[model samples]
Target chain A: MLPAAALLLVFLTYPLGLGVWLGFTDARIGRPGIFIGIENYEYLWSDAVFWLSVFNTLLYTISASILKFALGLWLALILNQNLPFKSFFRAIVLLPWVVPTVLSAIAFWWIYDSQFSILSWALQQMGLIDHRINFLGDPENARASVIAANVWRGIPFVAITLLAGLQTIPQSLYEAATLDGASRWQLFRYVTLPLLTPIIAITMTFSVLFTFTDFQLIYVLTRGGPVNATHLMATLSFQRGISGGQLGEGAAIAVAMIPFLLAAILFSYFGLQRRKWQQGGGD
Target chain B: MASVAIDEVYKSFGAVEILHGVSVNIEDGEFVTLVGPSGCGKSTLLRMIAGLEKISRGQIAIGERVVNNVAPKERDVAMVFQNYALYPHMTVAENMAFSLMLKGVSKPESDAGVRRAAEILGLVPLLARYPRQLSGGQRQRVAMGRAIVRDPAVFLFDEPLSNLDAKLRVQMRAEIKELHQRLKTTTVYVTHDQIEAMTMADKIVVMHDGIVEQIGPPLELYDRPNNLFVASFIGSPAMNLLRGEIATGGSPSFRGAGGISVPLASALSIPNGEPVVLGIRPEHLRLSDDQGIPVIVAVVEPTGSEVQLIGRTAGGEEIVANFRERHSFTPGETIRLTAEPSLIHLFHGETGQRFQTRTDQ
Candidate 1:
């Protein structure tokens, strides 16, 4: 306990207080100014580009989270089936998640290039389009491309966790459902989905939180490019704090993501409690 | 009301066969029990009848319909599992009404069906409660209630009461038997305990090694077993077997290894000097004068109603005697044991098959 407390004070509490304090001052790269309360937050409130960055973060989080859930659940269901070479397939499914995020994001960067991309080359060979597809040129296209990269790297984590959840359900319930005259669809709706709700709640919360504050894939792929169209709060914060050298504003932007994360966690916590109450589960 | 017939059904997994060509004919409203030890394929046979398992060969018919290719949902049979398998998310009413709802039953109609089954099982208060909220015995009743609401043609029970405690098991056993009598559903049950089979089954099929050892009424199997396996398996305290040979001389008698001779009350078709195994139930061995086989009492167990004595005969065969009259014979004391000649059973030594004995009528 002493060691843990000492580590928390030295590493976590001190830095958190310092960052919050820095958000209130006009601290630049080489100079520390007097404490100016609410000045950075006031400027951020009216800045159109700052609001756009918030919008971009919301769009990225919602789209990527929904896609990750749908595809991850599909992969989990397929992995749950009785097939030959099942363990081998499951191990291979986790490759993207196990590899370094920046390394894999580099691969996605090459694939989403405006010219000479393998995807564009394959599409040209199929005659789907006359010109080389500009994957990351337009603002909307860059936003979409970054979200697709995020989903690709995020799917394996969701799939593996949900797969562990699926294996915990007993086979007898399925047999009982089969004998109870439940069709394939009804069996999933009544048995699998309700039983899987808790795990889905947890997995989606983590997915949403990570996508909301994501930095690495966006930094490596777009770098808030195409006129700052896909600059999430995390990337914009990094741009101001480190590259632009406005430490105070960058800390303020980073601090702004807390309320949304709290909302997501509380929503999931209440949803989990409702499930427990409905199932008469233990406290 | 429907009869079930399993005609020479066999099941195999890859290269090893688990159930041999098994057959049984269950009449309408008959409570038949398939009883055996673990790994004897009794549960496998029950699953095959429910269409949960596919038969490798032969046919299973439920009321004239050969359901070999039917799915479990299409077969219209309900099963009570060993673990209950109640859906944890649904209330008791919903768990019971789920099948009817899937059959496109109306809300009021399905509610009425669930209420009727709840009444039959006395689960009215628990209709709004989930499975995890109920006790073991209550959960057991809910599992039966789920099956009852289905109103299927046949009900299958796979060791449904083995999960309960001893007192609860006996109580639930009686409850299941009573439920069968009140509903009169043609039930096929499986259990490893012979007492459950003997007390509850209208007909019992004893299985071992994936094959049917014997099938008969409870008392019939108890009184006249065709082989050594059936003779030993059906009774609570198993029958004692002694290796001996039957003499076909003028005064016919069976002689044991220690040269202890007990005369036969009847004549046998077996030739002289043919090796035979003698079987005698414990209750049949009477306590008499010193004119019978000599033995030393090893232990005495008094169950308030009867004195069960375990003794060793002079030829070194352990014999159990359940005597109605209490005798205060200490251990290492000498005692004489005898049996009425009619109570003795003789089987072929090598074949383990019982031979019929002729008695003067």
Candidate 2:
């Protein structure tokens, strides 16, 4: 316990405390600055680009998390079936997740490249497009493109975790439900959905947190490009604190994200609290 | 309620067949038990009857309609699984009502059905509780309640009491039997316990190696087993089998190893020196002082109602004898035991099939 406390104090609490303290000061790249009492946050409040980044972060996290959840749950269900080569397919599904984030982001970067993208080439070859798609050059397309990349990398986590959860449900329940006159759809709606809710809550919480703090995909693909339209708070924080050298402002932006993350955690915490039926004596 | 006719049903998984040409006729409202050892395909047959398993090459009819390709939901049956499979997330009432809900029954109707089943199973207080909250016996009752709520034509029980404790298993066994008596649904139950089959079934189908060895009332199977498997399987403290050949020279007698000879009933006529197996239930053997087969006593167990003596013959064959009147015998003591000629059973040594005698006519 002492060692764990020391590790937390050194690695987590200290860094978070320093960041929160820095957010109140007009700190610079190479020099410690005097405390300025929320000056950075006050400036960020009136800034349009900061508000735009906040909106983009929300949009990106919400859309990407939803997509990841739906597709991941669908994949988990398909993989749970008694298909041939099941383990092989399950292993293959984790490829996107296993690959390094930077590496996969780089791969997505090339896929979204305006001129030489394989997607564009295939579309052109199929006579579906007349010209190259301005994937990153267009603000809407860039946001969608980065979100798509995040979803691809995020799905395997949800799928594998959900698959593990799905396996815990006994096969006899399905047999019992079948004898109880449940149709195929009714079986899933009544049996599968209710049993899967707890896992869904946990998986989606982590997926939301990962998507909300996502930086690598955007940094590699768009770098908050197309007039800062795709700038998430994370990337914007790095841009202002490190690249733009406004350490105070960047720390403030990063600090502002805590409330949202806390909300997500609290939502999942309550969702995970044992339901009345789940609270019981030993089985 | 409806009769279930499993006519020449066979099941195979890829290359290995589990049930080979199995058939059983279940009358409407009759309680039948499929009893066997593990992997005897009794559960497989029960699942096939439930329409959960597809029959490879035969027909199963619930009532008069052949339900070979009918969906399980359309077959109108409810099953209680060995594990109870009571949906862990739902309350007892909800678990019972789930079937009616799937049938699109109205809320009030579904509630009435759940209430009725809960009352029948004595699960009224537990209707609001989850499965994990209930004891093993209670969960078992809830599983039955779920099935009872459906009011289907047939009820399928797949080793429902196997998971309970010994005392609870006996209690649940009686409860399930009583439930069947009250409901009068055509019930097909699967169990590996011969005792459960004996006590609960109207007709017990003894299965061995995926085939029906015998199907009869409990006492009939106990009194006259068709084969060595049934003889050994159907009875508790199983029948003692002594292998020997019939010697027809003087008096028809069984000549076993070590010069031990026991007289056979004169009504039986078989080829001279034909090898056969002799079967006698433990209770049929009586203590004798004079002419009888000599056995060296090994273990003595007294269960208040009866004394079970385990002894070995001079030929080194183990024999079990149950006596209603208690007598003390120490280990290694030689005791003489005998049975009436009419009580002895003879079977072909090679084929394990029982032979009919003149007295059987």
Best by DockQ: 2
lDDT of 2 by residue, B23-63 (tens): 89999999999999999999999888888888999999999
Model 1, which residues run further than 4 Å from truth? A274-283, B258-260, B291-293, B314-316, B359-361
Question: Backbone clashes per model, in order?
Answer: 0, 0
Interface RMSD of each: 2.8, 1.0
Candidate 2, DockQ to 2 decimals?
Answer: 0.85
- Segments of candidate 2 deviating more than 4 angstroms: none
TM-score: which candidate is best? 2
Specify the highest-lDDT model's number: 2
Residue-level lDDT of model 1, residues B1-361, one tens digit each, is: 7999999989998888998999999999999999998999999999999888899988999998999999999888999999998998898899999999889999999999999999999999999898888888999999999999999999999999998899999999999999999999999999999999999999999998898989999988888887888888888678878889988789788898777787776556788999989888989988888666777899999998999988888899988889899889899998888888888888889999988876322
| lDDT for each residue of candidate 2 in A101-129, tens digit (9 for 90 to 100) | 99999999899999889999999999999
Query: lDDT tens string, model 1, A69-114?
Result: 9999999999999979999999999998999999999999889887
What does the lDDT come to for candidate 2?
A: 0.93
